[model samples]
Target: MDIRIKEAVDLFQEVMFYGTERVIKSIDDPLWKEFSPEQIQMLKLVSREKRITSSRLAALQAVHKSAISSRIKKLLQKDVIRFVQTEQQDRREKLVELTDRGKEVLVQSDKVLTDYIENLLAQHVNDEEIDQFLTIFRKLKDIIKADGVS
Candidate 1:
């Protein structure tokens, strides 16, 4: 590989690993004690989509529908998410939505992560640099989406 491409790949890997580790550590609070990391991730996805079918979520997560169903069952037992029947003619379609408690957990988690990221950025980067990074990141995201990488 070209030297520049190799360097970029290495930097990307390092940044992803370090940033994820720091964010996970920062959010290791009592607020999340009752939830596993996978469960929290599911909640975050549901929070974003508002309501999504288990099959769609399974596709997004690259897991089997059975796995998604099991996770949904657990979330249901915890009273964090509930199944809502869609009004489609099929009538068998169900979507998962966050309960009040799920929303509260997601909000608190976002606040914690946001605070951590803001403080980290404040310590290492200025406004212009942040804007530049965001622009580049979004462009990359768009390119990946366009390429059907996910």
Candidate 2:
């Protein structure tokens, strides 16, 4: 690979891996015991959609149905998620929604992560750099979306 390409790849790798690890570690707390990253992601999706089926969640999360099932089971046991019956032909089928506690956890986690990122960025870069980074990040996202990657 060209030297420029190699440098870009190295920077991307370091930023993604080391940068993400530092951010996550900065916010490590007791809530992590009850919720893994996967579970938190699933909960956020469920929170956005008033109701979502396990199958739909699996598809959205790009994981196997069994993997989603296991997470659902754990969430259910923790009382973080609950299943509600829809008025459909199959009563057995149910949609998942976050419980009150789940919502609280989600909200708390969002605040914690948001605060951590804000402080971290403030410590490392100025507002001007944030604006520039956001512009580039949004453009990169648009490019990825247009390319139909994933």
Candidate 3:
């Protein structure tokens, strides 16, 4: 019985992984070509503030400066992110910000992603299942956090 439960759990997790891809694909054609996940996240972050620092981004995403630098370069090349050198004492600090197009993409892509998730929930999940899943995941999250996860 224990083996059967574990097998079922693994199988269900695999199916849900593929299911997320399929659901995201339903919105991919018209929007994904214009925005990647990192782009969307950066846009959303910068949209919340006029300017943010690279260190702040690295801290939030829990990545090294080099990785964030590479991503920021790509965003800069795509015209989705901008940087300004402020006149403050710390001239080396680049004030990274999102462009108008970046914010627009974030807002629009967020709408499409929300609609896709909503449709998927209606088709594949009931309210009780969602509530249960969230409860379980959050509980696990709390446990991991309590363990002092770095």
Q: Pick the candidate with the highest lDDT.
A: 2
* Every candidate's CA RMSD: 2.6, 3.5, 5.0
lDDT tens per residue, model 3, 28-111: 655677666665676777777678898878887678988888888888998878998977998988889888877777778878
Candidate 3 deviant stretches above 4 angstroms? 1-26, 124-150
Q: What is the C-alpha lDDT of each candidate?
A: 0.86, 0.88, 0.79
Ranking according to TM-score, highest score first:
1, 2, 3
lDDT of 1 at 60: 79
Candidate 2 lDDT, 1-150, residue by residue in tens: 699989987999999779767866777777865688889889999998879999989988899999999999999999989999988999988999999999999998899888888887788899899899899889988999799852
Inter-residue clash pairs, candidate 3: none
Give TM per candidate: 0.79, 0.74, 0.64
- A best-first ranking of the candidates according to their lDDT comes to 2, 1, 3
Tens-digit per-residue lDDT, 19-137, candidate 1: 77767766768766777666788898898889999987888777998988889988999999998999889879988999999999889877877887898889989999999999998
Instruction: List where candidate 1 sits over 4 angstroms from the true fold.
Output: 1-10, 144-150
Model 1 is weakest, by summed lDDT over 10 consecutive residues, at: 24-33
